[model samples]
Target: MGLESAVSLYDQSTRGRAGERRAPGAGARPLRPHAAGDRSVGFAEVRDFHVEVARRADPALALVPLLVGGDPSKRGKVIAASADLRSRGLVPGMGMVEALDRAAEARWVPTDMRRAREQSGLLRAAVRREVGAVEIEGLAGFYLCAPADREEALAVARRLEARVAEQMGLPLRVGVAPARFAASLVAEDAGRSGARVVVAEDFEQYLLAQPIDRLPGAGPKTAARLAELGATDIPSLRRLGLDRLEVLLGNHGRSLWLLACGQDPKPLRVRRHPTTLSREESFAGDERDPGELGAVLVRLSERLEQALQRDGLRAGRIALRLTYADERTVTRSHSFDAPVSAVRELAVAARALLDRIDLGPDSVRRAGLVLRGLEISGAEDRQLDLF
Candidate 1:
């Protein structure tokens, strides 16, 4: 029998790109390549390897992919309204004007990466609380221990699914496969389905047919380049010699080659606590009144204030989460010159943030608030006499 383990990778930055695109001048600095037989892989290859190794240890390895929180709209109103708008065909990244034009009643908004990260961290903690020791692949996804036996793995997957939903109020999908790549692929297919499993025999076949672009780590540019080279599918890419692949895609090419053939060598690392606290909510129905949504922001601001007070802290930075009913979420944040403790003050700042947001009623279903850059509050700071 192969190794009895599991692998999972949470796709990073799923909250459709909101920040300015990195300038070409801001490209990552080149790093030293691993010496042959170094037995060490770059950070980029770690998740793929973790899944592969876990699968080798356990044929029933489960692969779970988590969309970052707030990738969906952050406004409670928008998230609640998104399901209806989706049927009309709008999606994240659509221009506000275009989305509105496509569906007059559609609601749309930006995402909040900070709050999403916070919510994701909570989900990770919740998972860890239940499962004594599980591997967190990254910020948004993790792998739970699944046994080699089919029934047992499925049972574990079910439990994981329930815990995530209960704690985070977000749906999670789990896919089990004999190989890590297969499991990841299947998990993507099972998005929003909660849980799914694929056997070894079908795993390889499924992988072979998948577009190279669909593979983890193979982004749009890389996929387009591969297609240009007549390597449109995983099997075709796998058929190319390693040297040829390296020449075509550089180190990333070599990494992709290894992944294509299901030969990954990385380990899963545990997640750590973030430096901040945050929360997000989605509405159950579309709300046309911005006032109603503003009321939600008031509640969110109060919650953040209470949480900071409980921790004996004050926030120096704050962010807003806006979710369109179309499932698109956007986040914006700012740092103040001084720390703030009052919910009313935070709400004022949040309103300023909201003014910058253009998403309307039909598409908004969720909203989120994130507070960070905290500093310990002293008794003097809290006393009314200080003013």
Candidate 2:
């Protein structure tokens, strides 16, 4: 978009929000004016990360069909597969046994997450060298904010891709667009060692031409439901106004409607650390028993603890969200004097916060725990209390 249109959109998006309350470390920052006039956003993906890792590890596997995952004999699922296997419908998340059946001669490479993490860090550093900051998309991609117009954005992406390839020996495919989500989808569709650039004028037309399934959150079930509603593409989806979509699909439907209307971009984030970690579960029915709710909290805390340990991080705040059967939600939060990573500590804090909430006649249908104010495990000193 041009400078005027970009500023207009930013104003529209942020107009009426004054003194809005936001949870700490929630990644709630909105888009702001760029430092150097208008800029475009882009996504860069490390094409076939696992397959490339396997090839780099052993040159002999360069041309072979490789399936990366766990033991098929133990009900493992496919993590990544070679291009040939993917073309044959052997995609990630398929059962290893099924994947093996599809490509009988495909070599099985055990998932090397440690190596992947190391490589991903290297890739991010390389991209940041060219672009000041980036938002990491899982372990294989990055959301980059470029310095100037569409052409400059495209050139930046190209330079980053080439530099990453030279330094890390990994190929990157980039997509530049006026919107973040559009950039992500375009990057996913871009050819190996190439970039796709979508200008502001072409943004609307490009989005309308994309299949409905291309939008995130429009999974198989939602896509089928949309098809049943006679909406098979972005244009048809947009025709269903915001109110109708909200009534039919709830919040996700509203979000989809917004994206369909092209309200998806925001200022890019650096995201050096994950903003928040949360786990939630819905009850089979309305639940009033405190014991059941407490058990769920413990389970969620344990899951968060595992994630914290995996990431070598700790949380300084925890928020508990209780969703009533009527779809209303109440959230209560507490901050820790010292960051916590233990399940026991998290569960205790959550239970304390839960007790503070006045649960009336309403029964909770879902419970969730959000961990924020995160930092590296050893970043701060702990205070010891004398008994």
Model 1 C-alpha lDDT per residue in residues 65-143, reported as the tens digit of each score: 2111122333222221243354565444444455555666432333344454455455656665655455555555665
TM-score per prediction, in order, is 0.47, 0.62
Residue ranges of candidate 2 with Cα displaced over 4 Å: 1-37, 265-267, 272-387
Worst 10 residues of 1 by lDDT: 1-10
Write down the RMSD of all candidates, one decimal each. 16.6, 14.1
Task: Check candidate 2 and list the clashing pairs.
Answer: none
| Residue 38 accuracy (lDDT) in model 1 | 12
C-alpha displacement of 7 in model 2, angstroms? Answer: 38
